[model samples]
Target chain A: MTVAAEALAGRSARRRVRETVVTHVCLVIGVLIFAFPIYLALIGSTHTSGTIGRGDVPLLPGPDAVANYAQAWGIGGGRFMGVPAGGMLLNSLLMASLIAVGKIAISLTSAYAIAFFRFPGRMVFFWLIFITLMLPVEVRIIPTFQVMVSLGMTNSMAGLVIPLIASATATLLFRQFFLTIPDEYVEAAKIDGAGPVRFFFDVLLPLSRTNIAALFVILFIYGWNQYLWPLLIVNDRSLETIVVGLTKMIGSGDAQNEWNVIMATAVLAMVPPVGVVLLMQRWFVRGLTETEK
Target chain B: MATLTLSGVRKSFGATAVLHGVDLAVRDGEMIVVVGASGCGKSTLLRIVAGLETATAGRVMIGDQDVTALEPADRDVAMVFQNYALYPHMSVFQNMAYGLKIRGLPKPEIIRRVDEAAALLDIGGLLDRKPRQLSGGQRQRVAMGRAIVREPKLFLFDEPLSNLDAKLRVQMRAEIRRLQKRLGVTSLFVTHDQVEAMTLGDRLVVMHAGHAAQIATPMEVWERPADTYVAGFIGSPAMNFLAATLEAGGAAARLADGLVLPFADGSRAGEAGRKLTLGIRPEHLRPQTGGLRVMVELVEPLGAESLLHGRLPDGAEMTVKLAGAVHADGVLEVMPIAEALHVFDGETGRRIEPLG
Candidate 1:
């Protein structure tokens, strides 16, 4: 009986190892499939425009990598789009930061009020805000653009950021988190002589650090990847975000396209969002899964 | 330390009234425990004192001032919650010092008070650690430490030790009692555990259905419970109640099975033939010959002593506690000590005292 049991265990152990090997092989294949396009873009950016223009997809780097990146950084790629990639990157950074910060600040307070206070029409107001989730930027773009134009915010950073700041998704997430906080903490704070404002800044804000970090990463990427809103609202070259500017760098005619410089600009555009995710990865996972409270 | 008073304190949520009317005056430095079963309005009374819940129509006076209309922070009260409610992000020192900081105390004073509280609670080594890192007992100490540093007019503890394990609960209970006495802070503690209430409170207010049924010392409440509810609630294995009727000119009670046990204390005021309830503590029932017979069905050995659960001949369930182990499968004759008998009016459930 003991020998038979040992033989069964040995077979199961071999099966487990085989299953693990198969799973890892599948995972590596999946990673390569997803990363291949980005890897190709990286290789394409290093080559000269003439080499890419001849339609030879080089898997290796070329010597003109420095010249291509410098051109993209200083003068941009397409002739019609005169704004430098450097200026556009700065514009994108400002817009994304403003949107992320503004959304978090507004959502935190609004969610706090909704969760903690007993005001009339509170749920009504929450539902009103929630209803807007169904009407995304694309659904109400024309009216939003008209409002921006009437407010004289067109062709400015405000137009690019302010319209996207009121995020219902973030407010809902924060409200759910705030509701999970035990009423004992609120009572304890009150007994400790902390008023509503003091409690918000001292207790509520510190406890929400992880949630804020998680939301900031997601919202920053949301703001950074905005293509349509910035394209329509900002006509000035100075306010052109890199996402919209990158598309403009690729001209209509095949010969007119500066493929190498455009690829370099695309790579530059990916840096901030990727860096944000990497920096905030720990807090992001923790916030979504567990609450410090 | 200050006196706490509640006059005609009533609370209602919409149509459901939780506390009909509760009046309690706690002396300075007195630890009064309000204890009852769940939903008995003991917690509601504590919250009213803390200003966490507004009394429907009453006045709450802390020391010389009426604080009924004031917010919880302005009430000069500190509460230790059941879950401890320690700020998870803050270290132990910060949690203890938070109230003082909010009150705008000078930095040095705040540090001194927190350090003093930390030492008193024996948590000096854990001041730098966050609440999550501490064990159940340490967290309990931190919660008490937070309450101590405030030096508030009143301390409100809302079932603070219910979250600990059994052995730790007993240890913390003793520590809390010692600390409260040393600090001499007027406190109102609420709990459902009878043992906790008995050991901790200088005076216990036994609440039943939103009413303070009896208010007295633990021994007084034990020996002379004001009503059947208090009599049954304060004792473990509960005081076994037997239906009886006043007889022999209110000097004795006749059980349903025709056993007439004469009162050794004194004669009651009730007229003859009046329905009455006779309460006998489990330990007070002695096994003897020529006594009330009980059929022993289950025996629970509790180490030094054992509890015998059986039924009387009249079909009323009774429990008897006897010293040492007794293996009895048949009927056991147990007699109630005449001096330990408690008589209550059957209809009203109120104790019937002897006539003067």
Candidate 2:
């Protein structure tokens, strides 16, 4: 081949390699930017509170990792109004699991009825439920607290979970999914002598498995991250959730915070939600993006 | 198997009337096909008999039991849907056994019945496979097996083979007919395709505008349609209609172009100048030495026979099915066999039978 043509080809190949190198460098920087804070938290959890208060961020692990975790799990973090991380984690787990299951159950039934059955004021009822989508817990906190107070459910586990269970997002999601189910399935089930209840359990419920699994991940995270509602309703230390209890570990401006125990609590709190997402990663991705309908 | 009867079944959704008052009797072990165009309420009528739909006005009886008020479950009828409607989660065996399980049948009995049905449909090996894992025809057989295992009093089929390819549809059609006949189940099959209606049904109910235009055996409906609508709907390439008037004391009809054609039977009662519609199937028209002349427009060959589409001398278009292949470019003389000619009153569209 000609020398000029060979030179041009060589230059283009060099340019392409340079472009690839630049792209990888940029992606590495992006990853570090996101991962740096979590790294700092992990390093902080392994240090003594004194090391954190020295006003320089600890870049490496310290020697107190085992002690900090043990204290966080066994004893309360702060001296006054403190709750153990272990009990609080259990409370959080129960509340989150209950909220997830409750939301899926209610949303599935309500969505099925709205999608399949003909009733008086069906659109009106659907709109009423859908309107709840516009109002999150922050907006209805005062009135909901008042109702919970009157029902005498405050300071109880039921107060922590039940009031947070009616979810319009999950309902709308399931309704969209249920709409994709063909009418022929219902008709075939009816002819096969399945009553409405039997059809719901046998055909409809089984068809909704992937959707349920997908929604569970979102609901679990949502339930785990809840702080304001639980703080308002449950002041009892025994009923404190991990998220709320984590905040209670910080002292006022003058007093030094138990940075090591608090960071350990944060790590522990990350475990369940992260584990759930990882465990159901396949279905979560599928449910969120690929609807068979 | 049981005899089925629908007396004056009527339905309406709000102000839109879907099914007018209708009456039909389905004999024991008979398969009656309800055929019509979309929106003709054929599916609605089948749903009513299946108890999936409630008729606004009528009594439905399966054998001696009045099933108008019963739920589909209590009505003891099984249906095969157009989409097959196999449960997405269950294996074929589980799907077939579910109804029996619901009825609290013994486990062994359920197994035996499901196995029997699977063997009958040639789907025994597919019993453990989910519905989505099977092909369309396999899913259809599974659906049929599910229905067959129920041993219900009546069977309802709502265009079940419509989803398959043409060849598969033809094969499944014959299979379904053979199975239904072997089982001797009273069945009502609904479809919009006239070929399916003709080949599958012992009797055909041709629906038109929410009304039963004709109810008769396939040959009877083809040979002597009760009205112009039925005549036009039941035949492929459709029946040719031409405007004419009764003359010669109803013994003959005078065409719009001033040609006269005799009716098969010696006719008697119509007024001489009454406007009439003459119906002739495509296969009944023949080339004659002296007949109505037509200007040929297009020809469609179907291997064994060729259809010559042309305009009659009166300017009305018609199609003639000629035996073997025939090429026509300009004009041809074609005449309808007198015995195959149909006459209807132009105003009411009702058949005008000869006074025998």
Candidate 3:
């Protein structure tokens, strides 16, 4: 028998079907719990723009979807107090890109150094980086904001990107992943006259594509979903991101609020990160499980 | 090929010194195997020669150039690790071609050289296969191919065949010897197995406790060991040792239980009445009708011979490699006649060279 057939032969047809049924049931329940709020918001937008009560659920998508999207993007906003969700969408994309690229660049080089080089104080530096992960981000918010202000980086993507670049957790993970690679490959490359940089880019990076992809997915989602720091720094309506835009949509208090528009904006804002998750679905699972130890 | 020379090579980690001032010369096209027990610094000496590791205080010369400060790549040498460190992601062809590619050889030249080396190692069929797909012996051949394709001046092997099974290890050992002879690169092979050293190396360096006990031909080392360690380590089932003293005017070895073995030569030189160790090979001892009375403890029968492990008088251990299947009876008088016993200084455990 073939290896795949032999592996599957141990389980009976009944057991396989039973497992599939249970997995599908759990997924259905989870989808229902998450999708209910968007349904109500969408229905609230359709019913003359004020019927957001939970008792009446919409059987179909609301007709006011396009109108709400335009209003959220500030096509008909009275002033700029309501964030331009279009500009926020663009900021989220640009900020997430900068944070992803910068974090990967820094983490890759740092991980390479810590994992391979025999520099003095390497262990001490690695321990220091590891210790930073224990301090909660919330506790440092006020000081971090002041530091950002002093650096004149208070209201830009750089402001969003730089504070996120000090991530010791990502650096530690990448270093550990680099460590799992056998020293033999690096040694062989060195014996072939490969320099340190050549070893990283040529040997190490090629072998770590899936890992990089996985970390990109995770960090992109993290930067996209970030709130408190951006809320404090980005008071300008034009600079607010998707999360802050969603918060404004939820907090605005007029009786005729279009819940459908808010729900559509929320779902649209989540598209890119969700797309990243689906694209790197395999690598996300593999990389996370691989770096567990 | 280049002549590799190591002078005053010493290595230590903190207070623990492993290699103590080893000096040796490896000629071009010669295969030298450093044989020793574990932690005896054989591998350390090989690494220092390859420039993979730095010596505490030494001069490493390749041909006429001093490479003490140069890295391994600058040394223009290649090594085969014990674990067969083939790059897992690359095919056999790529692994063989990697060094040449690093040196920026032309594409055709790299392919030609890799193919030639693979063919030489009888791994032509396995070129496109990754290392994981190949078996143990195949992986070993590919590893050798990786080293010799560059026509390096020196080849350093750190127990290359240690990971193979017994039968395959012997086969690969012979193959490696043949390959080294064909390539004519000066090679330094480190192994804890004396049998591998004897079969594969032209000259053997026997080490003990960070010291070179003897560096000579394998036969010379086996026949005339410099010390008790070499004598004991070079043979299988090991050399049997008994506590004794030289008496009767240095003409004989006197056992504590009154078993006197007279040397064929006149006397044991200046070692008269001094405490000594009686060394004997198992094959040298036999069960006679009546010579010395002893009891049989156990008899292990091989297809060709039977090994008897028992005690001599005064409760010291002894072994006898006799012919045929012999059952273990209670008592037997095993006689060891003239010229079969070896005598050594008991206090220092140093071999006492027999008188002419």
In lDDT terms, which candidate is top?
1
Judged by DockQ cut-offs, is candidate 2 incorrect, acceptable, medium or high?
A: medium
Candidate 2, residue B277: Cα displacement in angstroms equals 1.3
Q: Can you tell me which runs of candidate 2 are displaced by over 4 Å?
A: A1-30, A76-82, A291-293
Per-residue lDDT of B1-356 in model 1, one digit per residue for the tens?
79998899999989998898889899999999999999999999999999999999989999999999999999999999999999999999999999999899999999999999999999999999999999999999999999999998899999999999999999999999998999999999999999999999999999999889999999999999999999999999899999999995889999988889999999998678899999999999998888889998899999899999999988889999999987878999999999999999988999999888
Evaluate chain B of model 3: give its TM-score: 0.95
Q: Could you give candidate 2's per-residue lDDT for residues B246-298 as a string of tens digits?
A: 99688999988887999877694778989999998899999996787889999
TM-scores of chain A across candidates = 0.96, 0.92, 0.84
Native contact fraction of candidate 1? Answer: 0.95
Colliding pairs, model 1 = none
Which of the predicted structures, 2 or 3, would earn the higher lDDT when compared with the native?
2
Rank order (by lDDT, best first): 1, 2, 3
As a whole number from 0 to 100, the lDDT of residue B116 in candidate 2 is 93
DockQ of 2: 0.66
